[model samples]
Target: MKNEFKGLIVQGDKKFSIKNAKTDYTGGYNKEKAKDALVNSKIEIDHLQEKLYASGTYSLLIIFQAMDAAGKDSAIEHVMSGLNPQGCQVFSFKVPTSEEYEHDFLWRHYKALPERGRIGIHNRSHYENVLVCKVHPEYILSENIPGFTDIKKINKDFWKQRYQSIRNFEEHLTANGTVILKFFLNVSKDEQKQRFLDRIEDPTKNWKFSSGDIKERALWDDYMKAYEDAINETSTADSPWHIIPADKKWFARLAISEIIEDKLKSLNIKFPVLDELEQSKLAETKNILLTE
Candidate 1:
């Protein structure tokens, strides 16, 4: 099943198509089965994260990019609930503020990188510069890049530079022992409409609904093209992208947790081994405590 999920990985060697990606995939998995699998995956993730923290050699950066109401928040909450918060940092990138706008796009994101021995989760990350701003080029103007007084200057070369910048950024992190897992939650347009309707019809979820969401839905195709291009341009062997089938939240959560577990196991991190002196000290301390 995990290997099947690997099919969702956007291979840089191949031509990526967002339209062909699965959104409502269950792989014959029912909700109960997925939930049971998720429980096991979470337990393993907790143990693996402990090894990562105890070893303090590598960091894990999990990035989530998706359309509006595509379950990024819920996926983060559920799949990551088992992690030790002390060794985990989660940052949600909303619209950039005046201060964030002052620097290069990656500046704020770089500051949020997880230190070795921890897991960092970014909800809607640096990819937004390419995904959102690609659809609406005007947003790039707010960055105030010199020589870009007109939208005409923000042409193909400009986007190419941005994608290259992202690749360089991830490559540097991987070189420095940060394992990157990028997920693009693939939710069908019909599924998104149902979610929006749920948010509207249920009083408890009304806060989640916004008129802007409807406006964005109108540009679904544009966002898809942006996402397809962004994934193709940035995905690499080091920083892999998983296009999760997000229409079924349970399956998506299970798949993501399993993928994360697989990556962590591949790292083969273990608790730091103490030297002979430290080991003797542990024995002496235990003896003293027992005598007391």
Candidate 2:
């Protein structure tokens, strides 16, 4: 595993630093290069997953966070396309259900965690408690916490508390043999506008483009601030966030593949060795084949 944090911005004010950590992949969106990287990454991840499965130890959780039209879905699809379906699961978090709202915020997230030897992907995760909740406090009415007062102060305190809770939760998971990788797809405003326009122009994609999307776009600056704050507060050594430059989809996929592959490689997984009896039987089979 690469000990050096690849493409991470570790400096003053993680929130502000993350916003400025953008890169233009010199290779641009080359499908061939992207696909090759994806294939290699999947192979490495699969090998590690197999070893973990055999050992009955360690789970992997990958979280993807991005603004609307930031290629989160596409990145996951392309980067992990070659992985075995049985060894992986994907969870897309959405508006909380009545039952989910009844429990604490983290409870719902905890339930979806990956089991040992498996890889789990979260499309948008518990961070919503801070991101969307901070942007639109009206969303919290669904939570139905009694005597909710001072919405501004309450929201601020809630996010800070949530960040701490998330850190503790990740620590617990790590202690129990889980590796967590969090990613925030960083897309520029110009690129986002182009994507939105593409959605409007293409009939098949029109359904995905809701009028509410524009409303959200209007609050881009606010959301950006929220995202920066969330990433800064919660990004810890146990579960650090990778701020992926997503203006170019192919490059974004490539970068993600590299990160995942490196992490898997660090696990140092290998196929189980055969016993003496098994080795002798294999030698006999090889001799028979040679004679034939």
Candidate 3:
């Protein structure tokens, strides 16, 4: 983790209260500084990713979770600007399709994971099963889960079990050389309302506004508690969650890219070196080319 932004992390033994977390932090950086920082981080990431691909020893899985208008899309677009497309995979999860609903919640996500030496990004990930479904237990009925048709049965115990499943799933991934980083774009209700209004007022952004968004906004408190519980429950040492201050979109992108660079730097990945046999073969090939 970056030294300046270390306080934002809520993982393992760190207790979290979303109500107390900040919605805007620039980490002493102004807009110009933050933009410069983001660009530098992207450059570092480009070199690091090439080394990662050559080494092929590890993979990175980054998860983003947030309320509407929290800037998840923009953050991804900016922070990942210079990365090679072939080494990166981005998945945006919406409502589950019929086929997806037929399987375990983690099945599709597990299949979408990056192969060795690549990075996988989830705009909204498996956490949805616990967050959104926790907010609306009725949605669980659609999955046709055994003994879960009754909303009454979707009790505290059911959520605890889901959290356990997530922990186990991440544990399995980490043990197999996949590093996980989860981020929650913590935006304030006031800020969100302003953003929603901006969307409605601007003709270009009018399509972003939907009546369903307002319906979800009405349940903001419920969603907050759901996020609080999900973050506290699933965050582990290996798979940590960072509660990003997202009210300032530029700062959010800066912080995210910095954290990513910090993690990749920790890996100390390097390009592969040829062995003696390969070196001799290369020399022979060079001699043949020279003769030609």
TM-score of 3: 0.98
Q: What does the lDDT read for residue 266 in candidate 1? A: 94
Alpha-carbon runs more than 4 Å astray in model 2: 1-5, 9-16, 26-32, 146-155, 272-292
CA error at residue 81 for candidate 1, angstroms: 1.2
Candidate achieving higher TM-score, 2 or 3: 3
Model 3, 1-292: lDDT tens digits are 6667999898889878998998987789899999998898899999999998889999999999999999999999999979999999999999999999999999889989999999999999999999889888999999898888789999999999999999999999999999898999999999999999999999999998898999999999999999999999988888889999999999999999988989999999989999999999999999999999
lDDT of 2 by residue, 76-167 (tens): 89888877788789999988998999988888889999998888999999888888888887777677677564465465676677788878
Candidate 2: how many backbone clashes? 0
Candidate 1 lDDT over 1-292, as tens digits, reads 3666778777678768887887988877899999999999999999999999999999999999999889999999999998899999999999999999999999999999999999999999999999989999999999999999899999999999999999999999999999999999999999999999999999999999999999889999999999988998988988878889999999999889989999999998879999999999999999999999
Off by over 4 Å in 1: none
Root-mean-square deviation of candidate 1: 1.0
The predicted structure with the larger lDDT, 2 or 3, is 3
Which ten residues in a row are the worst by lDDT in model 3?
Answer: 1-10
Query: What would the TM-scores of all predictions be?
Result: 0.98, 0.86, 0.98
User: What Cα-based lDDT does every candidate model obtain?
Assistant: 0.93, 0.80, 0.92
The window of 10 residues in a row where model 2 has the poorest summed lDDT is 4-13
